[model samples]
Target: MQEVLDALEAPPIDPEARIALQRYYVRCEMLRKVDKRYSEDGRSRITLLVRTIIESEGNENALVEPVLVAVNSVLRPGWTGKGLAFIEAFDGFPFVTTLETMRGLNLFKEENLGQYLGMVLHNRLLSLLGPPEALSAEKPKRKPARPLRRAA
Candidate 1:
């Protein structure tokens, strides 16, 4: 609980609280986005009225929609390398130091703050590059094996 809370310090605001607010917003959008495909207003209203569930029934409180929107807007899909540097400053670190498990934080010094931020951002980049699965391109499906020909 604390870890999640602590990891949400988004700077300029209580990051945890902002996430709560964002979830509420997403719930509302899920009911009525511009597209017909996402129009769940009737069902959403009924579910809210009945069981009072405010989030996706079995989902992990997904941030994919927001993340994808941000990533696509800037990263333009298939854009790789350079890593998540653009987001590191707001990634629960900002003006603080991030402990190994992302479980700790400390105020940044006036002078050394930028250096520490660089280190943290660098580590994040390394982490992104280190995972081959993450870096690998989405593979196309393999064609069916060609039929064996008789040795004539």
Candidate 2:
């Protein structure tokens, strides 16, 4: 994936974030190689990467953008399970805060990449925003009772 490589090469705004992104890029490349041979092993490796990204501190765009680009490669059409697993791996971490910066990036320009990622990250976003109750302080209205129907 030239896109992924380009993202990895792009310098991050923060020096520390850049280093972290570089380490992740190297690990991702290694995992991709292992994944080609082992096949089954790719799931766990991707999960590990997802966990590491979410657990990482700071909201630097430099770090978030490339990491997501690299990860998105594995989240293709045939990898629905991995996408779901990726969301599960969030485990209460508010990663969407960091991901917000990526919304305007070009990485999502790829076909359905943005939509696919949106689906994968939907659960995490919901968690961050909380239940519908939290979204609006107003009390929910109760439905009115319907008139009873006559039996034949």
Candidate 3:
């Protein structure tokens, strides 16, 4: 939403941090695209994996192990290898957006993780496709001044 975009554009943060955050946002959006293509059961399993990852609180090893298990157990047959590959490729860092999304959905109170995941995924997709001009903080353009008229 505009709120998130505005937050990204807010001043005073370290420029490196801002860039990193934007990159993470893009990565999550990419993951969301992959996630959205899953079948219903696969999506449910992915939601569970996301919950597990969030609960892991950035513990890389803790997140990876159980996710591997879930990938093998919950994903569609023969997709386990692909799922594992996806995890390996994308799960390098704990995404702040994922945590915020989990909190926003109140994952603890929700029985249906799939719906929440869908909401987050859709938001990310929208962000990815949002106004390209708004992606960065650019200084406002000043109109050119008219040539000074000669005194009549």
TM-score on alpha carbons, each prediction: 0.21, 0.26, 0.24
lDDT of 2 at 13: 39
Candidate 2 lDDT, tens digit per residue, 17-116? 4454455456657776866543434334444444445533432232344445444443433333444544444445444543454555656554444355
lDDT of 3 by residue, 1-152 (tens): 22443433322334433343344445556666787643344234434344333333353333322223322233333323344443342344344454446668664433343344444433443343332123234577999999998998
lDDT of 2 at 22: 53
Better of 1 and 3 by TM-score: 3
lDDT tens readout by residue for model 1, 1-152? 22332344222324543453455446657657666544434333222221111121322122222221222222211223333433332334222222222333446443343345445544553464442234455577999999999999
Q: TM-score ranking from best to worst?
A: 2, 3, 1
Please tell me which predicted candidate would have the highest TM-score against the true structure: 2
> lDDT of each structure?
0.35, 0.45, 0.40
- Candidate 2: regions farther than 4 A off: 1-12, 37-123, 126-152
Better of 1 and 2 by TM-score: 2
- Model 2 RMSD, rounded to 1 decimal: 17.9
Best by lDDT: 2
lDDT (Cα) of model 1 = 0.35
